[model samples]
Target: MVSKPALRTGGYIFKFFFRETKMNISISKKGISALLASVLLTLAAPVTTLANVKNPGLLVHAADDEATTLDPAQVEPGEGGETIILQVYDRLLDIDPYSPNLVPSLATEVPTIANGGISSNGLTYTFKLRQGVSFHDGTAFTADDVKFSWDRAMEMDLPEGNAGALSDVVASTEVVDDFTFKVTLSEPVADFLNSVVVAMVSSVVSQDAVEANGGVEAGSPNEFMAGNMVGTGPYKFLVWNRNENIQLEVNDNYWGENAKLNVRVEIGGDPDVRVLGLRAGEFDTVETDPSFVADLEGADGVTIYTGGLLLEPLHIGFNLNIPEGSLPDGDTIPEDFFHDPRIRQAFNHAFDYEAFLNGPLAGYGAFNPHYTPIGIFGHDESAPVYAKQNYAEAERLFKEAGVWDEGFSVSVITEEGNLFALMCLVLKDSIEKLNPKFRINVLAVAEAVFDDAHAQNPLEYAMWAKNADPAADPNFYMQAYQHPDGEWGEVHGFANGYKDAGKVAELIDAAAVELDTGKRAALYKELNEILYNDPMWLIGAQEGVVMAHRDWLKGFVQNPLWPRPSLKFALFDK
Candidate 1:
């Protein structure tokens, strides 16, 4: 089984110290004396001697752990790996940094119905790669590389990877020539190009590199390519010092103008530490939590970029199949309590949305009722809204479900984070206020333990968040909750015995392949209505993504589709 290299902070420091001093100890007495004299001369050297040396450029602080893998086909999508993958790989098409439209990158131009690149039926897409491009490893990039990269991603079918974005839409690919290829879809899909360009999984990789590195058939978490990279992007993979930092150098052989500065991405999980580091000038830019926004405002030489509503939303999920006493000792819930839709709907109405949204969220988040967030397509503005506090309705639903008299008690599990833990407490308070015997417990566990519990045996009720693709398409956002074969449903829904779970999955499948935009939107809207009524999840609010950077940093574009800013075109003035 493939596994990530363990964090070796102490080992790295020891090796660095030993390597730096090893040569010094080997010198003879006469050579040592000469070196000492040279050192004294350097100490006496003019200040201009050191001042003339060039700066290596920017130092960035990432608000995440070390990446699990760097291979485009195997890396998890979103903030976890996309931030680094964008710097090391180039895709056939890309979203415009300044706009939402698709733009040409490795491909010569954007394919559209009017551009003739897309067939009239929309089932066929043809692309011409930019000529004279070379990978970081010096292999010439061709149509074969594109085919091989996409085929590898689909064949591997890694659930955590971005392969899910295209696995449904793409049927197969045909290499027309060295510089051109065509993608044939099982059916016409309007968002096909957007899906390909916006997803890093579609980034081309060197075919020769894969074969040398055990090939795609070697299975997921490919050990060889995880630590190495062979892509045609502006930056090349240098080294990843686990738990410490990742270093990247500019690719001089790049087809386009390379980044003027090399990047050093340091791993840091504490938002406060990142803020202090940025203020101390140790970091040129950092991803910050919403709580840090107020402190960062008006600081000297600092600029904060706030995003619009995020596509991801935090919600409380129900494990309908949860068994009695499945939770930690001393916390026991009925086995089939959540199987009734009325209980789920009661919990939905019992939430104090206004207090939570305005209090913990600092009024920065908006109430979201549907599985799909507000800004994404297919979101119905006029959809029925859930009341912030409806004790009467909640009581009525509980009674109708035959649980109001006895007043059942259950616990809500969440990972340890200030915001998440606080949300769990707020939910518990709201639900318990309904009846005298009603009780709701809040359980906050360590992130690692929580992840294990969530994967192994999900609690009866839990609060969590989900991320969507850059396209903000409803087809991508809603699939996680509705698709029968989806990772989320398979793990959290089917395992817990959700009622008629396959109904929504059928709707999602139809919307995914539908060619007409209006029809597809209708299908999604209908699906959202069904979920809103059934109340599979107690949908919550969506917080805006906030980031902080030094004022001298320029050209950093914020894309709403992504959780973080894109630094591919970012530069340092000094």
Candidate 2:
């Protein structure tokens, strides 16, 4: 039984296994001495630069997530501030770093109704700017800086801002001269130009560097544009240091292509210190983990792109209220413990989904349904997917929901060391190997303590895992993960966990104002067959979009609709 050689790299094949350790990274209550003291403080830090930054015009990367805010109307949505607002901001339509199509940076064309710049009752859009550009503090990029950067993100509606992708359906932002701009829209969205003007919170910035630094108020959070950045793109802002790194530099009044290289990013959250600083060339690029692709396979010059399927669907959720005495130390569960739809279809037929797509997605991924995320537009490759690991139909639906021999202990949470703590240790080893008095536990923590216990409202954990925020359509993933009042259904209560939750919020509010794109893909393929028979999230596995870098690091563009650490350093160079 000897067959394992597969490598490839630039054309993507990868099958390596020359292991002394190919993932035994057990994240059980964070041991391994805090991951070997974060890999010896990422091998004794100090690779920093910017007091005369150097080396063939700099290019670092190394990220695992930093950038809390360089404030492109307060970033947040897979925040590393969207790889620093896709390199110092400028989005009035952009996507297509490698293809979800819409291009026209700082708006020059893509509006449609066959380019009448939209307004055939699609509630007006009109852009046309991008003339002599200019805003890395040089000011002049107008239409009043796209109506003061979307009216200062809908008047700073910063509740952890992403300003509901422009306070959900704009409704006014005109300037119409000095290179014209318009907007209108109190409705008629139809994927508003691939989801909110190619969103990085619809960038644009610099209405004279935010009214000379500190202007737009209403809900607050400008604090000098949350750590300064002035915009117009092609790399500009150059200093962040918090948690160590984020610098950029090549914009020299950039209006078009000037950004040969000069970026840093580097806030390395140890994936073995970003593969030991990308095999010690001191990181040309890093943050690539499919359980650390055998520590960057044949590491000589490292390539590993492995791109493709990413509408980002990693699910697990389930919460349904859990607050009372917020379960933790020996989780006893039951604050309506996932409000039974046969105990949420017996934890979605006891999820093993091919051992989580060959363990923590090392076999890359697939399989998505609730809120339909495969490649967007109503993804129904014949819907129904439990990825077949039945275990006697999850022990006859946990003994017909009588909680199978009265057993149930909980705790799921995640985030500690990526892949949502290895898919919560594959759902605590597939439901405690199907009931040895079924207990499960995992917890993990640390992405800012699991985003402050996943923003509490009721999610004090009965289950929690992540992924899903990368969309070109699928009505903003059925209004923030299957609307029951949307946004994790008003923080996990899904109006007391769905069985009909008002007809899945009336077919996600009639597929978000459907302008008949085949009746909004038949009301999102009938809410993916009514949430695949009433399952309120367990959707797991939909990954694939790797990266790795440094075969002389030229023009990196792995797309997946570009956002989360999806590198776009002004189309790299070195």
Candidate 3:
């Protein structure tokens, strides 16, 4: 799927126009009718498409699901499924674009432990909440909201899927005053500042609102979250059609310079519906498939922004379990998991990494990435790199590892219809090529996949998200890929950490304690190298957020928080 660069701008910037789609398509019986109809239309009309509006404000699209609410306390960490989380909700701290460094979200500075270092005895930590911020409701924000949100998100029983990340961090909370509160950490922590980077709790959700909506429950998402967002952000919520579409109007009451979009956002739905609409020029901004980037060329006034997935790197996971370990409840890992490490190794080598990147994922910043959070400090280029289509070498590895038995059966799990599932299909093709006898089963639903993936013991699950605050610290992320007693996620035991958890723990701890950049960098270097050789996760192309907009759009660009539009900046061109 690799293509020679059609245009180059200096050595640093290579402009690749479009990557062609390469999915194997054997004409289907059902598609034949549509294919013939298209062919007949092509012959009948010298298609003359007309010009129209390129972008429009307060865009509406049709999507499948609607968020439950706009309450930050509810969808705070934000769902990967919700592309607009950032547009509606923002943190007090922010990610510096160029350096991607962590800094104040709600607070002006990182809270210092010395002001009261969380007592080494693992008892308590205290902080002063930043003042002057107001909630969307116009109520004055206070310390109680902080205590309430923290207690609600961490200690309480929140939604199972959305609230998994904050499990166990809070022990109790106390509001010292209108602007001061104390949080008791279950354990003394070095990266307590990392906690704030999580979409700030009180910064977006008020204490009273929580009680009215669902209180400490932080109940499932509702219209408040889906269509209406109320945070201390530069823009206020205008409307959201759940998954189908959404729009964000400016908040003149914002604390900073307001976002420029007359309204920012429109997303989700049929590609052809958007395509024909865009070609007619009825819309201003919308996504055009990278493969169709060629068609977009020469269309007057159309500009296809160029970028790639430089951060939020993607990866497929292997979930092989060993028999010796006990589940958290003391049940033993199933024996089938250890049937052979070579089988696990085969899947790793079989990935068709380059094909998808240069094809469907082209132009989205889908590049081969090393195992650090994209754009983070301490990324080591020398780490064992996984790149391109390596069918031959993957086969060699399979043979060398003895995975070529006559009948090898394994199930690959991924959420159906997602890019991750598509990646699994690519790997399946490559693996089958290596060992003609190998059999792969692809499962698309998350619930079904989770059932098998999170069972008492697992054989394997392809790249499902390993959720945690990677921006805050890699320690928790590193801790995630290990054999576990069912503590974190069911797949924990199969991740890279289980093989040598003790060593991984030691190195990660050492890296955390070293404050000096030079020392921290050195330790991190060692960590990436260790992780590379040990290979916890099968890293994939770091892909950027894929979004669609009408051609009239000018200012809309990918936001770091594009995971959801809640944080997106959009204002009309003057």
Q: Give the TM-score of each candidate.
A: 0.83, 0.37, 0.71
Best by lDDT: 2
Which residue pairs show collisions in model 2? none
Rank list by lDDT: 2, 1, 3
Global local distance difference test of model 2: 0.75
Q: Report the Cα lDDT for residue 317, model 2.
A: 85
Number of the candidate with higher lDDT, 1 or 2? 2
lDDT tens digits, residues 1-574, model 3? Answer: 2232332211112233222322222223454355445434533544333333324334433222344444444553444334455555555456554334555555555455364534545356555556787777787777776666565555444453334444445556788888776767555444445533354343345666556654453344443333455566666666654443456666666665566555533343334334433444434555443544554554454455554333445566555443344322322234344334544444556666666565445546544333455545556666556665556666765676554554455555665544565556666666666677876666556545554654533433433432223344544454454213333334445333345656656766666555456876777777676655455466656665544444455455554533432224433342
lDDT of 2 by residue, 1-574 (tens): 1123444332233343222223322232254445455445544655533341224678988777566787877777777778787788888788777666778888778878786988778889898888888888776787887787878887888887788787778878888788988888888878888888888778888887778777888888888888988888988887887776878898878877788988877774656656756655566887775766766766665678887777778888887867688788887666886787777887888878776776556778778778777766677788777775677877897898777887878888876756767677767777888888889888776676887888788677788888877877888888887788988888887778687799888878777777778888877878888887778788768887777876677777767777766668778877
lDDT-best of 2 and 3: 2
Candidate 1: list runs displaced more than 4 Å: 1-56, 158-160, 330-332, 457-471, 494-503, 563-574
